[model samples]
Target chain A: MSRLAAKFEELAQSGRKALIPFITAGDPSPGFTVPMMHAMVKAGVDVIELGVPFSDPMADGPVIQRASERALAHKMSLRRTLEIAAEFRKTDQTTPVVLMGYLNPIEAMTYEGFANAAQRADIDGVLTVDLPPEEGQECSALLKARGIDPIFLLAPNSSVDRVKKMDAVGSGYLYYVSLKGVTGAGHLDVADVENKLQQIRANTQLPVAIGFGVKDAETANTIAHLGDGVVIGSALISKIETNLDNPEQAKNEIVELLTSIRQALDCGLGTEGVQE
Target chain B: MTEKYNMPDERGHFGPYGGIFVAETLIPPIQELNAAYQKYLKDPEFIAELDADLKYYVGRPSPLYHAERWSRELGGAQIYLKREDLNHTGSHKINNTVGQALLAKRMGKTRIIAETGAGQHGVATATVAARLGLECVVYMGAVDVARQSLNVYRMKLLGAKVVAVESGSKTLKDALNEALRDWVTNVDNTFYIIGTVAGPHPYPAMVRDFQAIIGREAKQQCLEATGRLPDALVACVGGGSNAIGLFYPFIEDESVKMYGVEAAGDGVATGRHSAPLCAGRPGVLHGNRTYLMADDDGEIIETHSISAGLDYPGVGPEHAWLKDTGRATYVNITDTEALEGFYALTHMEGIIPALESSHAMAYALKLAPTMGKDETLIINLSGRGDKDMQTMAKREGIEL
Candidate 1:
């Protein structure tokens, strides 16, 4: 099994909701990225999502867009992002790192190049926001051949028919965007998400992760109760932006938020020995 | 003459401006377009469809009307207007959209996607999609959704799905972002119907070729009416499709001077301008290397213009090439000046032109007074201003 699948299975067996923290690589600089990954893992994050910055990020909101801009200002490319992952793997090998970004950069590098680079860098999975499963056959096949799970996003606007289509190609955890617009624009419609999750669960046996607007602890806890995993992006990027001038403080703040969410999910799961 | 039509010199320069400065993924596609266009230009079927559509649907042979009153008011030259505003969908934008949609059908693509600002291009794409029975998706900025709600409704009514993008600055540039994302995802079965001459290689060339009908007809009409071609050809330069179309056929005619008018919201010196050719430097934007108003760090600066259609910071690569080669001159017209021309044309000639075309009218107003009485000038009236009526009324403090 892939690292992402194993992590999901372990969380399922423990009856614990997985906590995923998203960070854009090279936001502060390449020098600070590996340490930041270590910090998130130490704070009890079950999965780490590293964002590969693209010149045009359409699905991201203002906070993440700002973070991407900062990264791009440093001339962050896919090669540099993978190098950061490779550096992190030297110290820590167990944490599952999934590269989440738009498809342009990956497409800019051919599918074979991306698959080989991800494998060599110890990257476990990829979730391209714009690459739907129906159109990702070549990339998915390439990644699957190399044991890297290709994750897909299912949204409220996606129909049951579309969910079945995604199920055929989607592996590892399926990301469920709670809203229709870009990330961080609106409040989470919990009922709408729950209904969509239930519909998606009926179609696919893959683990479902809810994202897009789970900002505070309350929303994260609520979403964790209904879904297999919770993905946090804009709020984490906002924290990093607040403490950007001081890297240590920024890492501390991000870890604090992840720790609190991890503890809350553990409490809901009734897991006795899970570390927060 | 044949050399004039050929493109991309040894160094990828289109008269010293255009070049392929794109991601490696797009290299194959750009090369494919170059090869396809070369062959397609000679194909009888391709020429037939394009000609038939231009004649029947686009209402080609748009008249060259003598604006006698406005010309007399200028007190010098006899000015004429090429009436592209009379085309279907109320703008010259339809000409390129129809051609690209037909190409998409020929390429065996079943889905089409486009990006829009004031929704002129969206309406044009939706119209062609409905005609061709292709599924259409339009990406528009959230701010534009509120401003151009009627056009959005029109697009939906024509059976196209409109996705409002609330990212970046929430403008035309952001709409372009979403459309790029959609194109990358569905590239296999989808054809991106780029509306302007600003994207990667063949798009700039293809859109210009489709719009070239404007200059071809205008040149004939001007010669028939005045026994000689106009001394000057003026047109607005937002992405430069209409301007290039009206200027290409006349490029070899040294007697006819060409002027491209860009939008100057306040003034070019104030940094609140869309004068890409007048003030911008060479840069890559929207997949094509062109002249763009970029900052010290090469980041695209936000442009200001009263006309949403003219608010982009980058001009088409072909226009940049034309400007560099000294084949065409570019100038800036302020919002106030364009507004004056807008009202002047509406009352004087009974033609309410698009705010974009009004920029050209404003330039003509300035140039006509300086020319001799024997001199004739032609200005491209690119589109009707009905879509901008509400904005104009609001700006004039008139309530709906």
Candidate 2:
């Protein structure tokens, strides 16, 4: 099995909901990333989504968009992002790292080239936001062939048919965008998410990681009872954006937030353990 | 050749160019939109209402006037103007906006949003929203807002809330990014009227179909006047709507050579131009895989053009397909040459053309002298030059 599948399975065996923290690969500077990855893992992240910043992050809200701008300012490319993942893997190999972003850079690099580079970099999975399964078949097959799980997103509006389509093409886990809006949008209807999760579960046995609206530890705990994993992106990137003048301070803020969310998830999962 | 020139296939692939390359959250909204578009496209009542609006409101069948003097001066091909500049809102943009806004109404969407470059599409979209009493928001790059303040004010007068996006490069592509972000957030009740023949599946094909009225009418008008189809067609391609609008109908007419002109701002050799089909490579941007002005690192380079509309890094995906399949010839016009075309048309024809359209005029200026005078060329005068007065005046050392 791929590292992503193994990580999810290990988390399920431990009766804990996975905490997937996403940070753009070279946000602020290239030097700030590998250390940040270590910090997030130390704070109890089960999976790491290292964002590959694209110039036009169309699906992202203002916060993550700013993060991309910052990353690009530091000359972060997909190749550099993979190098960062490789650097992260030097110290830590057990934690599954998913490279997340748009598909253009990968397209520029060519799918086969990207898959080969990603596999060499010890990257576990990829979640290209703009590549739905319709255009994802060839790239997904390439990634899956290289033992890198091809992750896909399942939205609130996704039909059972769409869910099955995702499940058929996607491996590792299906990312369920828990809101009707872009990443960093803060409108969460737990009841709506729960209803969607029921449909998603009925269609796909692949682990579903819910993202887009999980902000606080309480929300994370609530989500822990509802899904296989919780993804916190803009909330964490907001720390880096807020502390652009101080990278260490931003790192500390990220650690502080993730530590609390980790505690809440561990505590909640111990008591309830994903009430599915 | 609506039957013969069926390029996008059913799934919106103009060969391997256009496809739905958006995030998962957008799939359902676009699918819902596609369903409504498909339903209304086949509905005769919808077609009747659209026709009535086009005829009465937009003043359709914009005349094809022969530029006899200009053609005589060029001393080669007799050139004709399709005169899309005479259309309502001063461009062919209204054709698509009016159609989309009507579809949005049928879909029960209360809000209409759009992105604009030279602000023609913004004004066009705003005009429809005002007519329909729908809430309208227009995203323009901060650079475009500053440059095209006249159209910004026009949009505001049409009751659109103009948002100046201060993002990467601050141009049409940035405005599109902000608009896509807005659409993703407000997909529930909002109708995003993309300004051009780009953006995912239904948009390229749907916008092409709406704008195809330009070609459909021009073809008949050319035949009626000249006793045969024109030998050549030329249009400026900024996200390629105007060009596609003119070229799509002529695809099956193999003898009618088509030219899609792109802005070569400093010249394509300088790498400071927006001629993607001329200089750039294929990559995905703004929900479609198309020819883009991206660097080796896949970062969209800042595009330069005297015309704000043509200052986009990517062209419409179908243009890429057309270029690849050898159905159309794509060329570039420099800012200096385009300015010369702008002045030449103003002097020779007494008709000032939009700077965006000036690119096509520039290409025509070159090609018209080379072809036989008996052969005719129809230049899609896509918009009026009123919006470009400030830039032109500035170039002439006049403050106003």
Candidate 3:
């Protein structure tokens, strides 16, 4: 099995939900990304979503957009991001790294090159933000050929029929955007998220992970029971944004944030896990 | 003729150029929109309603005038102008906006949102939303808001909330980014009325269909007036809607050659122009794969143009496919060349052209001089220069 599948199986055996943390590669700094990935893993993150910074991230709100701008200022590219993931694999081979971002960089690099490089970098999955299944066939096939899972996203507005279509091609997990808005926007109704997850679960056997508007431990815990995983992106990047001057402190702060969410996921404090 | 050449494939691709390259959160909404657009496009009632609005509200069949004096002065091919500048709200933008607004109403959407660089599309969208009693919001770049204050005031008067985007290069691309964010957030209630032939799957195809009226009308007018199709067609390409609007109908007519002029700020050599099809490579930006002004690292670079409407760093996907297939030729006109064309047309023909259209006029002026006097060339006069008066004054050492 792929590392992603194996990790999910391991987590399922432990009766615990996955805690996925996302951070833009080269944000805060390029040199800081590998260390941050290791720190996140040490803090009990099951999957690390390393964002490949694009110049215009239209789907993101201000916070994540700022992160991309900062990262781009350091001259970050998709190639460099894969290098960072490879660097992280030097010490930690068990942890799964999912490259997440818009598709332009990948399109520029060509899908075949990206899939081959990702496999070489030990990257386990890819969640291209802009590439839905309809447009993702070639990329998905390339990734699958390399034994890498091609993940997809499901949104609140996703109809049951849409979910079924996405589920048919999606692998690794289904990233369910918890809100109707861009990343970091507010107004996440927990009940609404639960209801959507129920609908999504009925159509797909793959684990469904909830992202967007997952700000802190409380919300993460609340969302924990509703899905197989919780993805925190803008919220963690906010820590780096607040601590830009001190890379060490930013890493510590992100680790602290992930630790809280991990504890919540493991203990089932906010709500009951599936096994519980 | 293949049925696919005129429109995008089922996946919204024009060759390898266009696709829905948006965030996963937006996929469902985009899919829903594609379905809705496809349904309404085939519905006779929907087409009838759109046609009625285009006729009565937008003032369709904008005159195709023979620029006899201007052609005589140029001393070349007979120059004809498709007077889209006379359309309501003073631009061809309303052609797409009215169609989209009607679609929004039919889709039961209660709100309309759009992005504008020069504020023409914003005003057009606001006008339609007000007519339909729908909530309207327009996102403009902060830089554009400062430059095009007149259109900003006009949109506000039309009862649309205007948001000034301050991110990225703070131009058309930034405003588009902000608008995409808004659409993704408010997918349930809002309809994004894209002003150009860019964006995700249905947008490039849908906007092209809405604006194709320009070509349809011009073809009929040309045959009636001159009794023959023009030897060449010319229009400025920003996000390329107007140019595509004029070029799509004539695509299969091998005798009718097409020219798409882009805004070359200083010149293409200076690396400051917004002529993506002329100088850029293929990449995804705003929702679709298209020709983009990006660097070696795939990061979009800032573009410069005197005309805000033509300042975008990307061209529409279909334009990319057209350029690749050799069906259409893309060229660039310098800001100085366009300014000259602007003055020449205004003084000689008594028609003040928008700076965006001036690029096409500049190219047509060059191409017309090369052809015989018996040959004919048509230019899609995309908009009027009324909105650009401030920019013009600023350039001439005067303040508005």
Candidate 4:
């Protein structure tokens, strides 16, 4: 199993939900990205989703888009993003960093090159927002051969048959988009998500992580109680964008926010077990 | 002047304005389109099908009518209208949509996806999808959803799933974003029916090629009627599809000057303009390297226009190339000027034009007064004003 999958399985068996914090790499600057990733890991994040900035991020909300824009402005190409991961790997290797972005950058780097780069960078997995499983067989095979998991998203609109097809191809974990619209638009219909989760659980034994509009601790806790993992992206990016000039403070604030949600998921005693 | 047209290179770069700069995931599909287009261009079967569709379905060879009343009122140059509005679906957008839909069928794609601003293209795409028995999905901005509910319903009625995109300013750009996302995800089985002569690679060239029929027909009609081409040819430039279509055949005709009027929503000086050719610089937007309005920081700013169709912050790359090469001149027409021209055309000639087309009309009005009486001008009436009637009525304080 991939490190991400193994981690999720461990958490699932222990009756603990995975806390996944997403941050756009090189947002504000690359200088702070590694530190931010480390801080999230320290703050009780189980899986870290490192977003690779793209010029047109259609699936993202304004907050994440602005964060991506900031990163791209600093010339955050896919090569630079991989370099950041390589740097991050020098000090830490067990965090299971998954590079999440659109397919253009990966395609720009040929499948073999990208798989090799991911292996060198110590990337645990990849989840392209736009590349569906049916078309991703080659990429999946290459990444799998290199021991990098290839994750896929399952939307509410995605049929059960389609989810099963993705389940056959996907590794690490399945990302369930909580809403039909783009990130951060609608209120989370928790009931709808619960129903979809039930449907997904019936077809695949893969660990499912719910993202899109999981803003506050309450919603995070609610999603954690149901799914194996909870992914927070737009809300975290919004905070980072709001405090861009002082990234340290933004980092602290995000760590604190995730800590609170982690505590909530653990019923208020999660901080006592921090290794650091 | 060259009698035969030269094909643009594989990159779709029409002199530096157009090129495929899309994501890696879309490259294979773009290449497929390029190959398909090259083959289809030479195939008599494809041409016959498209020709028949244009003639019967889109009501092609639309009449070039002399606007005698408007010309007499202007009292300078003779004015004529290339009536593209008379085509089915009430706009020039159907011309490209139908052609692309046919191409999509030839490519063995099962689904069609498109993005729309004013919902005109969405309706056009959905109409073609319905006709061709393909599943269609259209992405429209949530803001546009509110503004163009009728078109939204029209698209749905024609058997398309309309997705309201609420991200990134919740406008046309956002709709384009969602559509791009969809295309990336479904590129294997889906054909992205780009509404304009924009985007990466084959799209700009393909859309322009389809739309170029306008200029080809107008040129023949104008010469037959007046014994010479018009002194000036005018059309509005959003992504420059309609304008390029109307301007392409006349590029080599030095005496027949071509004008692409952009929407100066407030004014170019105020930075609230859509005049990308006149004011924008080279930048990457929507997967294509093109001329776009960008701040000193290279950030794309929001553009404003009374006409949603002309509200984009970028022009088609070909227009930027044409401007640089001196084959075409780009001009800006302000909202007030376009509005005034809208009323003038309606009152004088009893023809209501889309606000986008009014930009060209406004420019024609400005140029008519200085021209000799014998000089004639042709304007591409790209679309009917029915879509804008509600907004126009509200702006004019009409009860309806």
Candidate 5:
């Protein structure tokens, strides 16, 4: 089984929700990404979603967009991001690292080339922000052939028919965008998310990870109870953006944030002993 | 040849060029738009309403005039100008905006949003929004909002809120990003009217169908005026709406040659031009698989053009398909050549063409002299030059 499937199975047996912390690769600089990945794992993150910076991030809000701009300024490319994942794998091998970004760079590298490079780099999965299941068949096939899980997003507006289509082709987990807006925008109404999750659960057995507008431990912990995993992105990147001149402080801040969320998930859910 | 040029086979692939390469959150909205478009496109009532608005509101059947003086000076082919510049609002952009705004209304949308580069499309969109009394917002790059203040004010005067996007290489592409964000956020009540023949499925094809009226009218006019189809067709391409608008009706007419003029800022060899089909490679950007000006590592490069409308780093997917199929030829026109065409027409025909359209005019000037005078070349004069006066003045070292 892939690292993602194994980790989810472990989390389920332990009665604990997974904590997935997202940070853009090479956000402050190329050297900081690997260290940040390690820090996330130490803070009890079950999975890491590393953002592959692009010049234009249409689906992101101001916070993550700034993260991408900073990464791109540091000359971050898909190949360099893969190298970062390879570096992160030097000491940590069990955590699944999912590279997420728009499709242009992958198209530039070609699907087969990207899949080969990603596999060689120890990357576990890929969630291309712009490529839905309809447009992702060939790329998904290539990634699956290479033992890389193809992740997809499920939005609040996704109809039952669309969810069924994604459930058929999608692997790893279904990233449920918990709100109606882009990342980092909109107020998360837990009730609205719960309602949507109920609809989504009726259709597929794939693990559903809820993300978008997850700013605090309270929201994250509340969301943890409602889904298989809680994915926090813009909130963590905002910490990096605030401490760009101090990489050590940025890493510490993210670690502290994720650790607190991990605590909240454990305490709030009254689950088994914390991973740490 | 088959009488039909059927393409974008159900999956939105224009021979592997156009597809829905947008984020997952966007699929449902795009699918809704596609369904609505499929429904209303074949409905006779919708067609009649659209045709009536095209004629009565937009003042269609814009004349195809033989530029007698300009042709004599060019000294070769008798060149005819399809006066899209004379269309209401002084450009062909209104054709697509009006069509989309009407569709938005039919879809029960109360608000309309759009993105603009040179501000032509924003103004066109704002005009229709005011006509329909729908709330409108337009996203423009901060750099463009500054360069084209007059258009910014024009949009405001038309009661549309204008948002200045200050992002990476703040220009057309950034504005496009902002518009897409707005659409994803407000997908329920808002309808995004993309200004180009790019974006995911339904957009490239839908915008092409709406703007195709230009070629449809020009084809009939050319036959009526010259007693046969013109031997050649030329139009300037940015995101390639105007060019495709004029070329789509003629794609099946093998006797008519098509030329798409791209802005070669200095030259294609200079690596500064916006001629994606001529110089760049295929990549996905702004929701479609098309030719783009991206660097080796896949970073989108900033494009240079004297015309803000043609400064985009990508072209429409149909143009890419057309180029690959050898159905149409693509060429480039430098800023220097376009300026000469701009001045030549102003002096000879008393008609000033937009800098975007001047690229087509420039290519026509070079090709007209090489062809027989009996042959006819119809150029789609896409817009008027009033918006370019400041750029022209600055180019001549004068403060406007």
Candidate 6:
């Protein structure tokens, strides 16, 4: 089994939901990402989704876009992002780090080249925002061949056929975007998300990680009940955005925020891994 | 030449150059749009309505006026101007907007949105939306809003709410990202009228079909006037709508050559330009895979051009496929050369061309002199220079 499979199985065995926290690599500065990854792991994040900064972050809202701009200014790139992941893996080899971003950067670094670099870095998975299954055949196959799970996104409006297709092609958890808007723009309706998750559960067997509006402890805890995991992206980036002038303050805020959500998950989290 | 010149096989790949590469949230909506577009494309009723709108509303079949004076001065091939500049909205942009607006109404959409670089498409979208009594909103780069203020005011007068996008590079691509954001949020009642032959699947093919009216007319006019097809076709390519508009219908004409002029701001060598087809590699951006001006790190480089419309890092996917397949030759013109073409055409033929169109004019000037006098060339004059008077005046050190 792959690291993602083993990790999810371990989470299920412990009856604790996965808490995936996303942060753009090199956001605060070039020296900021490695320390932050260790900090988040210490704060009980199950999976660290490291955002590879691109000049055009179309799927992201203003907060994450700002994070990308800051990261890019430090010359952070796909190669640099992988180097950071490699740095994080030096001492801590158990935690799974998933690289998440747009696909052009990966295209620039050829698929075979990226897969080899990722394997060397011990990266676990990849979630390309704009790469749907229709265009993901080659890239997904390459990642899967190298034991890196290709994570696909399932939206609120995904059809049953698309869900099935994603289930067959995607190896790791499926990210369910709870709302119809860009990341960090709209308030997610729990009822709507719950209803959509039910349909998605009926169609796919891959673990579903709900994101796109997992804002606070309330929203995160609520989302934990609806899916196999909860993802927090812009909300965490917002903390970094607010504390750009002070890296220590930003790290403290991120740790504090993730800790609260971690506690929220532990309090009354649903242990039901896939509906009976 | 034995086979028909069909492209972008059903899945929208112009030989791996175009595909629907968007986030999952946009999948259902774009799929819905594709179904509607496919259904209405051959529908007699839809075609009739679109044709009527083009003829009566947009004043279509725009004249193919021979630029005899300019051709004589060039002392080479005969030059004819396919006068899309004389269209109702003063550009070829209106051709796509009118078709999409009518389609939006039929699809039961109540809100219309668009993104623009030079503001021509914004005004065109707003005009069609106002005619259809739908709410209109346009996204433009903050820099373009200041430079193309006349078209900005024109869009407002047509009842569009103009939003200046203050994001990455703050140009055409940024505006497109903002418009995509808006569409994802309001997919229920909103219809995004993509102004160029770019974006996701159906958009490139659909816009090409609508704007193909230009090539259809120009071909017929050239055949009627000269009793033979023109030897060459030239057009400026920003998102490549105008160029594709004039080239699609002639793709099977083995003897007819095509040239797409890209904006080389300072020079491609100086690394300050948007000549993607001329000096770029294939990459995915703005919902399609195409040639893009990206660094080795895959970050889009900031593109510079005297024409706002052409200052984009990526070109339409079809243009990429055309360049690769050798169906079209892609050339580039610098800001200085395009400006000279603008002035030359204005003085010689009494036709003031848009800075975007002047790129095509510049390339034609070079090629016309290289050809024999008996040969013929047609340049798609995609837009008028009325909106560019201020920029020209600024260049001349005169306060407009």
Q: How is the predicted docking of candidate 5 categorized under the CAPRI scheme?
A: high
Question: For candidate 5, what is the DockQ?
Answer: 0.85
Candidate 5 lDDT by residue in tens digits, A1-276: 999988888888888899998888999888888888887888899999999999988999999889988988889999999999998898997899999998989988989999999999988889999998878899999999988999999998889988899899988899999887889986888998999999889999888899999998999999978999899999999888889788899889889999899999999867485656
On residues B73-188, what C-alpha lDDT tens digit does candidate 5 reach at each position? 98998999999999888899999998998899999999999999999999999999999999999999998898878889999999999999999888999999999999999999
lDDT tens digits by residue: candidate 3, B3-30: 3455688988898888888776677677
Better of 5 and 6 by lDDT: 6
Residue pairs in clash, model 6: none
**Recovered fraction of real interface contacts per model:** 0.06, 0.88, 0.78, 0.08, 0.81, 0.80
Q: Give the native contact fraction of candidate 5.
A: 0.81
Q: Quantify all predictions' global Cα lDDT against the true fold.
A: 0.83, 0.92, 0.90, 0.84, 0.92, 0.92
Candidate 2 segments whose C-alpha is farther than 4 A from its true place: A271-276, B1-3
> Which runs of model 6 end up more than 4 angstroms from their true locations?
A270-276
Query: Taking the tens digit of each residue's C-alpha lDDT, what string does model 4 give over B199-229?
Result: 8778888898999999999999999999998
Tens-digit lDDT string for candidate 4 (A131-166): 665446888999999999999888766677867887
- Which candidate number maximizes DockQ? 5
- Calculate DockQ per candidate and list them: 0.06, 0.83, 0.70, 0.09, 0.85, 0.82
lDDT by residue (tens digit), candidate 2, B1-400? 2337667767788878989999887898999989998899999999999999999999998999999999999999999999999999999999999999999999999999999999999999999999999999999999999999999999999899999999888889999998888888888899999989999999999999999999999999999998999999999988999999999888999999999999999999999999999999999998888999998888889999999999999989999998998889999999999999998999998999999999998899899999998999999999999998988888899996
| Per-model TM-score versus the true fold | 0.67, 0.98, 0.96, 0.69, 0.99, 0.98
**Candidate 6 lDDT tens digits, B127-241:** 9999999999999999999999999999999999999999998999999999999998888899999999899998999999999999999999999999999999999998999
Runs in model 3 deviating more than 4 A are A269-276, B1-5
Better of 1 and 4 by TM-score: 4
Candidate 6 chain A: worst-modelled 10 consecutive residues by lDDT: A267-276
A1-276, model 3: which lDDT tens digit per residue? Answer: 999889888876766888999899999789999888888888888899999998888888999899999999999999999999999999998999999988878877888988899999989999988888877899999999899999988888788888998888988888998987888989889989988888998899898888999999889988977988889999999999999898899889889988877777767743434331
How displaced is residue B266 in candidate 3, in Å? 1.7
